[model samples]
Target: MSATPQPVVRRGLLDEVTDRILAHIRDQGLRPGDRLPSNRALSERFLVATPTLREALRRLEATGAVEMRHGSGVYVRADLSRLIMINPNRLRLDGAALLDLLEARELIEPHLAEAAARNASDAQLDELAANLDRAGRALDEDAALHTANMNFHRTLGRLAGNRALAQVLDSLIDLHDQEQRHILTLYADRDHDHHVHLAILAAVRGRMPVKARRLMTEHLRDVRDVVIRALEA
Candidate 1:
């Protein structure tokens, strides 16, 4: 009889270990509030050292996955989505920090657009096309247009193929969007935004990296001016 082959084993980081453990529970059809194996048992089960297992458990607790008791071992509490989102207002950002964030974006994003122009596949370009269509439809509605535009930029960031850069840009953009929504309350000028965005999109579509870079720079400049003018007025 043929023996069953062992699966290839891989070592994972703390966060990945936590994700894997949670995934195991889900795949096994474990119910909510199900008890995970004890730390020592889990370590043995996964063939990981106890310290690494402990680190994973700590992250799960912080993220509100499992609850600890004085005597009882850790048990799954609930899903992570139950954790509240942060209120932007409560986040402390000083003027210098805000400037730094903006400058960082300026440095990172222009090149990202350039890279997207150079490297994005036809499928990815189609995604951008879809986003632009949504933006065009939302043009008359400033808030909706703003959302579409935000998504378009985020899609471009993703096309840059750098996960860490994209994550940082997402966070900064989220913060900026929250602040700008309050400051730029007027509905966006549909006629103007459509043309400007389309021009940028065209450069990207044509694979004109330099032109795409220029268009992106101009678009950001216009946005910065409008936001500053609105704040000052």
Candidate 2:
């Protein structure tokens, strides 16, 4: 008798396809504006259904990693500067716009950090610590590090134990990601930034609410200065 054929394991369709495509692009070192294979071709190659492929592509597009043209094809979109949305109706960027947002963050985030230091439970602190570790690792890389750092900030907000505050912080962070990435690209040194983050973490871990508050306020101020200087130059 002939040996039985092996059964192939099917992964989670949409998520797996999305991840695989993203990984392929990264591993292949595909540049921004590189055209992706057609939907039908990609679907055939990946053995995923057309709908699943479409969903995967949609996710990429939503994340500012890909762009689709009606008469053209999908092109990689890697301009993080253009990714930030300050005003929906405006097509231009002004320094004031970024400063305004950062000012708001300075007003809210330091107090939130203080509150988190005061109220965070052991489990919550542990989670925040773990996320910070990941952020430290990613800081050496370019795009990936920024994404991870963004996630770290979002989680930090959540750990503050205020749902409303967390939601607002998340929205602001999301809106600022593009501009943040742009500014950081100029002056960001992973090692230095990581040390600053470590300092903030230490204060938080020590449960010195006032110290943590002050440290984070300083950190934001430094960030604003760096960003403004870069923009001015």
Candidate 3:
């Protein structure tokens, strides 16, 4: 039998270990609410130190993947949808941090869009359309529109089917989700952003990877400039 592929990291970090543990659960056919092995046993199994294992377990708990009780053991949560969503309270973005965040988005998001164009299934496209539809109707309602906008991008990330990429982008973008209304104000044409999203979705749906990449890059560039303006204001 062919050996399973291993991750290329020299030693797994907390995030890597978190993914591994989740995979282990799935492979073992452990149902939601099933108890995971004890910390000592899990540490030994993963070849990680106790402290490192605890850190990984804590990360999983934060993402709602597992619940850790003070006296009780860990168990998987029934809802994993929370896994892809980031906690806004954990964000501490100042000027420099915001710049770095947007810079990273500019670098990564275009490629993600290209990949989504190549890899997205029909259902993913439908989800994108649904998000866009919701956003379009909520333009007058700032908070709702911003939320729909954020979901739209996150859905795009999922469409790429790259869990690592989706997780990183979610963390980075969630930093700005709360600030979206302020940043989105920089667009002179209120509906322009929605139109751009549609164009990107059409590119992805049409299997135009290059167009998808270009549109996504331009979208990020616009957003980055707006964020800079907002920070300066």
Candidate 4:
């Protein structure tokens, strides 16, 4: 169970509340199965309206971070759904399954890119551009480069400005990341991934929605081919 969380200093957004809750978990060394304080207590502690706190917890639940047990209480969870939307560790990530995932990406991501091109703020685009540079510098080195690559995609999701679509994509991407853990830890085609992201970002930055969609489609295709070859070899 978690210790008492610190009093929230002032009002904040749902994301801020989520971050603070996560920080508290890390700080308190809360383990899976640890029970959290009651909903009423947390609402008062965070200095937020009950509805906002519930919304933040809902996000956490979506991420597999915490479980709400009716008539029981809330408890920490190991965050399995980062197999999600199932745990990646428990599922068979066979080639057929992987291909299906890529197919979903092919169908969904181009639309996301189009949306991002239409809606992304200048600051968001700039961050993605900077991530491309970071990717170049960290090429194929495991954690650094892989993280930068994922960040670029996550940034794209945030830029799309549709919360439901972004959240669904986030879960799908998280599952893929879990599967890639083994391969990336051993080897990464960071250069190839890096270049593809660069092209995709360029299209988005140029405010060309159709072009962004085309580039994203092609990028996902390349990734699918690469993964297939990796599995075969």
Best by lDDT: 3
Tell how far residue 48 is off in model 2, in angstroms. 30
User: What is candidate 4's CA lDDT for residue 34?
Assistant: 94
Put down candidate 2 lDDT per residue, 1-233, tens digits, no spaces: 97888444345667789888888677768788888888899889888777778778877787767888887988887542242433444444478877887888898889888888888888888887787788777766788778777776777677788877776777677667788898897687667777777787788888988998998899889888888888888
Model 4 C-alpha lDDT per residue in residues 106-170, reported as the tens digit of each score: 88889999999999999999988998888788775677877878788877977999766766777
Off by over 4 Å in 3: 1-63, 66-91, 185-189
Over 4 Å off in model 2, which ranges? 1-93
**Please, what are the lDDT tens digits per residue for candidate 1 over residues 143-179?**
8877888888889887877767776777777667766
- In model 4, how many backbone clashes occur? 4
- C-alpha local distance difference test of each model: 0.74, 0.78, 0.82, 0.78
Work out candidate 2's RMSD over C-alphas: 13.2
Cα-based RMSD of candidate 3 = 10.2
Compute the lDDT of residue 46 as modeled in candidate 3. Answer: 84
Per-model TM-score versus the true fold:
0.63, 0.61, 0.66, 0.63
Off by over 4 Å in 1: 1-99
* Winner on TM-score (3 vs 4): 3
Give per-residue lDDT, candidate 3, residue 73. Answer: 95
* Candidate with better lDDT, 1 vs 2: 2
CA lDDT, candidate 3, residue 23: 90
TM-score of 1: 0.63
